[model samples]
Target: LESILANLSAGVLVFDRRFVLRTVNEGALTILADDFSGLLGEAPENWPRQLALGEAIRGAFAEHESSEWQEQIELEHTDGLPQILLLRGTQLPAGSHGGYVVVFDDVTRLIAAQRSAAWGEVARRLAHEIKNPLTPIQLSAERLQMKLADRVSGSDAEMLSRSTQTIIRQVEAMKRMVNDFSDYARLPAPELTAVDLNALISEVLGLYETSRATIALKLAAKLPPVCGDATQLRQIIHNLLRNAEDAQESVDSPSIEIRTRLADNLAEMIVTDHGPGFPPEIMARVLEPYVTTKARGTGLGLAIVKKIVDEHQGRIRINNRQPAGGGVVSIALPLASLPTRGHRVSQLPTEA
Candidate 1:
């Protein structure tokens, strides 16, 4: 049992009465980029990973009388692989030989999630507080220009009017940028209706039908109604379809296929295209606001898609298409048990 537990994939350490290393698990050794035999007797200074682990063990020893010692700690190993360890255990009963058991867990992913969530909150605040004020400023500028036009006449007045108009125009542009950021920040609780998923797809498809890219809607026959915000949901689709259309720009035969299907409990919308695919490294951060790949791109399209999907309690995943068409984006939205939308998806005119 001792060997079995030690061999498990958890960084573990046992310390004797003096807090000296008595045993280290295979997991702990692996994290240190070494085997247990090599690390059994070495002090922390000799191993970077074990230094953090060793400190955690000591902290556990000091609080031995407590019910449990649990802390999430970060460690950097000589091998360059950073590992997160969860130090957790209780003190052995007072005996001739006292010791402690500690467990190390890799929480790198959890920490990343926490960081993403924190930064997302900061972005939201910046958008709302900073972006919200620009709209009023723009309106005020517009009103001031109107007054200036009426109050005076001449080249000087014309200059003032032009200046005011420029201010208004720039402010209006900034407002749109702010709106994009605000969209990235503020989340709307979806008012899910029994939306004909196919109908919504068609409406968005028809809206973009004028684009040079050949867009097709492959709706699942007898598709179930989806629960989502009709307007924002359309925004999500529009953004994706537009992205696909943009991707298809350099393709020999530009084409985008909006395919829907059931994958377990979620409704999947896959937008596949034929163009140069997304760069692998940028792919992960592609959904983040303002992370565009174009020569002059705002990069908010996918970010807005991500935000809306999140509001609708859906997932948006991106991947390259099979057999090399281009990129394939999958949006899996939770199937609503009860009606989550108050609006419905109505087909729009293809010409619009």
Candidate 2:
């Protein structure tokens, strides 16, 4: 029984009727990513809030009639991504030594997969529905402009031209938008190769030497190469840099920082901007398609970045920098030929 508990992926915790933790299996310790020394005799209330079972344990004890209860909770990690845990709590029989048993497993990937699928379907439908008529609309506007050019005179001719130009321009913009949707819906699988991430960032930075925002780089001297598609990786750098530039539009002394380092056998890149951080309400869903805080944003930039990262088996995290203010985006990719350790399969949830 002990060996089985030790090997199980689901976390298991046994608490006495008094709410003091009694027995915790190895699976529990691994899932919580915490040490057992502090958890053995601690009550739910005394457990670290980020790792605590919270109301699930207490609610199970209170609902005596029900044999089992289930809940989903989000655990916030100050230095890492938030974890979504699905927990099931069962009340011990009255005849047995009374207590509650809680079993939980990380379900963050499952939830993310569901969201990705839903959004992909939405993108496909939007592209198919909106893209079909864009060319006809643009061509019709151009035809009207040419046909009316000889008939109208003076200011009337100018008005006709302006109206037709406006129609053409707006139609072109819509076509681009629809193309973005199509790209997101059917992004190609990346062709894997060894990529020098730092070199790629440097190359992308060359295009921004005259950018309004001052860009700085702090690349590691001995960072290892990562396995990724060079072209897609370049797109990721471009998207992040553009985001940082847009974020600095309102700042008097706009500055952006890009840093790269090696950690946990992964090549990690961090991009920071000195702009107002993500709004509180939309931070959680910021990575979702068509969700944006920018007035002119298509909101597909980050979504595509996420899709590419997911394909490369990497992780991305977004957060607001505290005390100093601004926003930070971090991407971590596995080192070439090195398996990622202590990393989950999904992107980290945004932190605010």
Candidate 3:
């Protein structure tokens, strides 16, 4: 019984009729981050802040009736993001001392997956509905400008020309927006191949070396390769760099730094910029689709980067840099072993 309970995937805890914690499995310890031994004789009344759990157990023992309940609990740690747990409680059968058993599992990833799937479906429908009419509208406006420019005179023609130009420009902008939607909605599966992240970052940085922002690099010399789609990874890098550039546009000493290192069996890349940090109101939901603070953005840049990172089985975190006025974006990808010889790799990024 002890061996089986220790190996169980779901956390389990049992309370006596007196509401004292009688037993707990290893899963409980892992899930709740509590020492099971210490909780053996502890009463639920003293279980700080566990209002729902205490209420369910007390009701079951008081009414002598089996009860079932479910609730979400947040687990915060010092190293990573807070986890969300789905907890279920059930009243056990009557005995000399009746008790209730609780089982819980971490459902954070499940919720995120559902959200991602929903967004992908929405993106698909939006791109299909919005993109089809843009080209025709643009073409019509251009044709009108060419055919009617001389037909009108004075301010009429000037207004006509301006109107056509605005239509053309707006249509082009809409086309870009639709393209971004398509990219996020139809993100292809990453073609796994051994990729040197440092080299990849260097190649991406080469494209923006001429920009105003001072781009700096601090790549780990002995970093391991990561198995991922190079094309998608490049796009991720492009999005972050562009975001940093946009942020630094208004700063006096605009600067951006790209750094890489290995931590906890993962290859990590961090992008930091000297600019105003993310607004407090939107920082938590910055990755959600259609959430943006920029005037010209579709708000899907970070969302798409998140999608690609998720596809690569990686993690990303966005937070304000400490000591204060800049933003940091960090991503960690599982390191991959070098591929064997004769292994076929995919085409160049352009083809992808």
Evaluate all candidate structures by whole-model CA lDDT and list the values in order: 0.71, 0.83, 0.81
- In model 1, which regions exceed 4 Å deviation? 1-116, 131-162, 322-325, 337-352
How large is the C-alpha RMSD of every model relative to the true structure? 9.3, 6.3, 5.4
Candidate 2 pairs with clashing backbones: none
Candidate 2 residue-wise lDDT, 232-342, digit = tens: 989999988898888888899999999999998789999999998777667766777888877889998999999999998999999989967788999999766554444
Give TM-scores for every candidate, taking all chains together and pairing residue i with residue i: 0.61, 0.78, 0.74
- How do the residues 164-210 of candidate 1 rate in per-residue lDDT, one tens digit apiece? 88988888787777666666666566666656777888877777757
Error of 1 at 86 (Å): 9.5
Model 1: which ten-residue window has the lowest total lDDT?
Answer: 343-352
Say which candidate scores most in TM-score. 2
Count of residue pairs whose backbone atoms collide, per candidate: 6, 0, 0
lDDT of 3: 0.81
Give the Å shift of residue 53 in candidate 2. 3.1
Q: Per TM-score, what order, best first?
A: 2, 3, 1
